[model samples]
Target chain A: MPTIRDIARLAGVSVATVSRIINHSGKVRPETEKKVKQIIQETHYQPNQVARTLYQKRSKMIGIVVPNLNNTFYAQVIDGIQSVLQKNNYSALISFSTSSDGSKYLEAIDNFKNNNVDGIITSAFTPPANWNPTTPLVMYDSADIQDKIVRISSDNSKGGQESVKLIAKNVKKVLVQHWPLSLPTIRERVEAILKELNRQNIAYVLEEVSESDPYLAAQQALNKRNTFDAIITVNDPYAAEIIKEAKRRGVNIPKDFQLVGYDNNILCEYTDPTLSTIDQQPHLIGQTAATRLFKMMAGDTSTNNDIINVIPIKRNSTY
Target chain B: MPTIRDIARLAGVSVATVSRIINHSGKVRPETEKKVKQIIQETHYQPNQVARTLYQKRSKMIGIVVPNLNNTFYAQVIDGIQSVLQKNNYSALISFSTSSDGSKYLEAIDNFKNNNVDGIITSAFTPPANWNPTTPLVMYDSADIQDKIVRISSDNSKGGQESVKLIAKNVKKVLVQHWPLSLPTIRERVEAILKELNRQNIAYVLEEVSESDPYLAAQQALNKRNTFDAIITVNDPYAAEIIKEAKRRGVNIPKDFQLVGYDNNILCEYTDPTLSTIDQQPHLIGQTAATRLFKMMAGDTSTNNDIINVIPIKRNSTY
Candidate 1:
């Protein structure tokens, strides 16, 4: 119940000094800061965050909007974002955009604006045509937006190219499973794979599957009786589903067929035959996005052309 | 940049009426509410949330603290909590307590108090001996806290009992892998399993493993050369790891050894031979905690003794 004025009076410091110590906005001597903190703790004086936010015009909070948290990739990305945010003395308000149409994303953005978050980082959701945001927006992995917004993502095209190069010589025919090509990230991966496969004169089949249940799509693909010698999946979970279903049908991995997955999540290592995967290093991607957002907030206009590189991790999945 | 006074003038309403409409705290007629919204939209008026918070003395925000989000079970629980919180018109400020010592949890609680959250929901971190909280707190999946704090958890004991019942008739010896037994939830499950196994006079071994890397623990357990006919894991990921390792060692599941996992996560169905596990229904647990928090926030003092039931799911792992 103690006010800032009371704290200042008790600590024998100016109100601005107390505010500086509380907000960590301006530099203060270590001794003075320690003493002020001690007094504040002793008094149990809770500063009103609303008033502080109004005065500083910074909430010290960031909004993170992802399509789904149930997916380990997204969860790991969030974990990376939080790691950086916590170190920088910021908190994250996370929301899910379960639909591809981006309605939930719009709602999340509106909520961020309403709460006056200092910045926002979103993954895989494009803003509507009529939507214009006043807050600084950083798009993660969906880089096809307007030039004003900052985009940080891994090199999906390069990952796709590498995946094909690693397995192209070993297989006669390959099945490339992916999500909808409407998403720019997915499109880039598919395009790169096709370009590489065509250059090699290798026969391949491309299948677009629903993001929610790639297992069912894998099932349908198997039932089609395609004579593919290998499978390339857009992500690790899809690769896992394919592996499980193939095992159910008595298909021998690395002997009868080879498989590769993207995102290089934990599932890739835990699966039998130890799945070969493209490591996007999602934690690094998240950290990069947070650092970029902070730089943008500080009025740095330097263009960031950095794309986190991907590496192909070869395990027991392919010969 | 438009002020509330300007909004009131344009909407033909008093400043207090405009405030009421903005806060959604008081009743406003349908026509007046519609007109006020129109004017507000036309002006692009962004309310100062800090000022609004000061006036209302409520932030309409909740805090959720969990140990980790990379685990799918925690992610699912958070998804459920967000579902309920969003429906109730509240935003969640989520934080993680990475360490088992409970320091991060205390910090999160302090942050929640400083931010004036209406309530808090936390999982599996005990407060320090000297710590006291003034905010309404709900402990999720950790029920061994003080008597004053409301604890909401699934019947982990019953889950352990059911897991044993499902696999008891088929196996001669069992290996139970879990995290530290000091945790209330883990203790409950282990105790229930042991009690049931003793009642049935079935021999079993208990092993505590590092949670961060259950795969390594599974490897170590397999390397110990224990001649066990079945394995009971505290969660699904560990079960998956054991299955992967067992298969690597040419150990066939349900044929060589039966397995039962807890939490019945999506991984259970995706693994080869499909893991039989206990279903804790994490979504319902989250929903129940949120409902209880809301009841407590409304000054309800009645004790809640409801325990969500756990079900045993049969799959190829347990025959």
Candidate 2:
């Protein structure tokens, strides 16, 4: 609980002399420095970062905001960001908004600004037109909105095209199960899929489903029996549900119909008839965002966005 | 970019008066406060948390350390902690130590202390004998080490016993796939399982497996097929891998052998035939750890450890 004044009083020196010794600035006699160091050690006095930050004008902290961590995709992204932060000797003030709403994101941003963060990196959220951020900001998990900020987004159009190409040879009619197109990221993928299917002259039907109860959506997809020869699910978990429901109904995968999923998460390999999905390289997205944030923090002003490529994983689920 | 001094100069008031108005600490004339506030709004000035923390001695920050985020178990724990943090209006300084080694954990602790964290909550790791932490420290994912610190641990013994009782009716012999017993948590479960099996007079064979390449472990376990009627895996993902390998080998679950895993993660439901596992309530553990940490930070001196109950989930993997 001792302050720098206490250390100076105990060492029989001026507070300015003590500050010079502590910060390794200004000239101080060796004897005075030795005495002050001994007293500090005896008192177990730790230098206060708060006080140092006042003079330095840098906290060496970056504020990060993510929607949630329950999904491995986000977890991997954080891990990637953490690795870079570790190497650079930086700490992160993390806020999990637990929602995609712009209000929650705004609150987090306000909190970070109050903490004097040098920069911020957050998942995609639409900011109000009039609310301009003063801090350097970078975003990920976006659809490349290009609204005066740098964004690191996965190649969704390429992902959608690959999803179609993965099962193209085996399908005459396709069923695409997806969530709301209101989400910009999802809209990009769905649009790309439709465009690709049309170019291939393949017939397709779009089915909107709920992401929460994916099992119900899977069962409904299977209830359509021979209506479609293939199903492209929203993600791997949704596709896994379809596989489970198919097993319950005694229908064989790849024999009766083929299935493909997006976001090649851990479930892709664990699911029976292993899921063929798109790998968005979530880690790369995080690394790129953090790297860009550091550049901005160092006074870089370029706002050009970046894109990461996706990989198509050919597992047994698809022909 | 505007400092408090600049705001005071622009408003023609003393810096102390500006500070008082910003903190709402001292009474000032209504006109003076209004003039200062108008300048502040025009300048877009944010009060530096570091300066406020220096006077108040409260950072409104908690340092959190988790082993890794790649697993859903840890992510859920972090989510639980975030929920409580949001409610309390606090931010988390998170450090993800990619290893279970004490050295990595110690480094994180040092970093948190240097940043003046109010308290710390970390996953289990052994500290050096002479390393006495001055901060309020709480641990989760522990084995109830009774190390003179508060701990929130899952009831590993009960989880082990439940795993045994779930398949006791159908199994004459069991295959227990596990990792190193040097880990305190894993050792506790293995000991409890052995005691339960001894009480039931069921024969068993202990097989050590590499957690990283669980598919190979599953293949190895099935190579000794028909020797044991049931398999107790280290965790849910390992069990999922077994199911995948079993399908490839034409081995039926619950018909050829009953299987049970630990930590009822999301993968438990997605796996074919489903999976019976022990739910350690990771979120509750995190919430309890954080709640206990806040109490300690509030000057509570008690150092008692707490345990969270585990639930047994029955599915088609077990009879």
Candidate 3:
């Protein structure tokens, strides 16, 4: 509730002088600046962000665009971003772009612009063509969206190789199950696994499952129970379901077949025997993205193109 | 961008008449309301929510208190609630109270109140002392939070019993793996399983694992490989991790052991062999909570004390 007048009175200065000190707009003696700052600290004076934003045309806010909130994989990454942003006094406005129409993603960008947000962090959704955001942007996972100055991604290819290689080491043949085979994480990992399998003379199957129909995965797994000795899935949720269908048909994992999931999602730990999957360090990714955004805002121009690689967490399912 | 004056001019009425029509205020003639509504529709005049909120002292917003965004289980429930709330023209302000101390939950509540939100949809964050909310509240899954007008929860007992029964049918022996055995879901399910095992003369071993630590689960499962034939976790994440650990030990799942998970989290479909777990229908739970919150705000008392039951989702994890 402390106002500019209160701080000015405590600092033995005019309200205008206090404003000058806070905004660094005008000449202030070093001693006067110290006095005003001390008074502000003592009075616990926090400026009204809304009023300041309207005049300055910028709020220390960012938009985080996510494809799904129901996936813990994305949630973990959000938490990481929150950790870093919270420390730097930046507020994040979250939008889940689930419809796939891209309107929600476009709306998010528009909302941030109208709200005078300083930056944006996108994970899957693309921006609109009608309105090009001049704000600083940091993108995650996908490199499809253009105009973002900085990008951060987990080395999905390495993770895939690590995941499938562990399985091929034990089981002579492994089948990689995926839906929407066009997805980058799925396709790239499959490409890496297929190469490794061919090189090692290990049999591998690339089964494309439809993500739209929830029942298709179980039905497909049921149809191909014996064609493979191991199953490496795109993520933990699919991996868990595969385990379920395999069990109903009287298949034992890592015995009759081995299994591996990706994204070391929190679900991976709580799974029946525990799911061994790749750990992308989602929190780290978020933190890095936020940090990079801050640097850009502060006028740092160093470009980082190194694809961050998180190690695969080996667990009960991988052997 | 059409204003009340524009609508009034088109409808041949005063601006106040248009205001009455838009605000749903009293003493507006039916003819005026119809004419103004038509004009408003023709012009596609969207009311400025923030400006209206300042005048009406209503945010048209709802506070969603969650344990943490890290858990996809709760996120699924939140998504379900958000989907409904968004359709009803409400905005969801989310807060995560997964701190070591529970006091941050108080801050989120106060923040919502400060923003003048119309209602709150909260999940399991214990409120601070002497804090009473003037807004309508809908609390999810707190058996102990005492308030006659605000509570909704799944039938934890039934879910526990179903999870236990499914494990019993598939595996000769079952292991109750969970996070902080003190959690209501974990505790209730464990008690229910003990009772079921005693009644059926089924062999079982209940293991309490820290919800935060998976390394402990890995070590314990390795040491007791001979003891448990199945592991039933309180949530999908735990079940997924257990599945991973069992794999690393060279133990074949469902051949040597069966695994049952809870929350039937969307992630359940991704784990290798998929997870056979109890589906609590989290989306319905959230949707119900948001609907009730809106109704309560509108002074309706039609919603009942909900005790939804979990439906079993049979997958491959059990033979």
Which candidate's DockQ is highest?
2
| Candidate 3 per-residue lDDT over residues B1-319, each given as its tens digit | 6776777788898876776666777698887788777777788786654445544666556778887776666777788887887687665656666663557766666656644568988876556566566678888865433455477778777877777777677456766766665566556667777787778787877677766776677567657878878777667666666667767777776778888878776667766667899987888888888888888998975435676677988887886
Recovered native contacts, candidate 2: 0.91
> Which runs of model 1 end up more than 4 angstroms from their true locations?
A8-17, A24-41, A128-132, A144-146, A303-305, B9-14, B26-38, B129-132, B144-146, B224-226
On residues B160-278, what C-alpha lDDT tens digit does candidate 1 reach at each position?
89999878866788888888887888888889999999999899888888878877977876886358888888788888888888888987888888888888887777777788998
lDDT of 2 by residue, A159-267 (tens): 9999999889858999999889999999999999999999998999999998688888988898996898889989998998898889888888878889999888898
Model 1 Cα interface RMS deviation (Å): 1.8
Could you list the iRMS of every candidate?
1.8, 1.4, 4.4
Q: lDDT scores for all predictions?
A: 0.82, 0.89, 0.71
Provide per-model DockQ scores: 0.64, 0.72, 0.22
Q: What lDDT is obtained when candidate 1 is compared to the true structure?
A: 0.82
| Candidate with the larger DockQ of 2 and 3 | 2
Question: Candidate 2 chain A: minimum summed lDDT over ten consecutive residues — where?
Answer: A49-58
User: Over 4 Å off in model 2, which ranges?
Assistant: A1-46, B1-45
User: What would the TM-scores of all predictions be?
Assistant: 0.92, 0.91, 0.70
Task: Give the Cα-based TM-score of candidate 1 against the true structure.
Answer: 0.92
- Put down candidate 2 lDDT per residue, B1-319, tens digits, no spaces: 8998999999999988998898778899999999999999999998877777765667889999988898899988888887787778889999888788899998888888877888999999988896778899998999977768788989999999999998898689999999999988999999999999999999999999995888889988999988999999899989998998899889999899999999998988878778999999989888888898889989999988999999999998999
In terms of lDDT, the poorest run of 10 residues in model 1 chain A is A141-150
Candidate 1's displacement at residue A297, Å, is 1.4
**Candidate structures ordered by lDDT, highest first:** 2, 1, 3
Q: Which prediction has more favorable lDDT, 2 or 3?
A: 2
Model 2 residue A124 lDDT score: 91
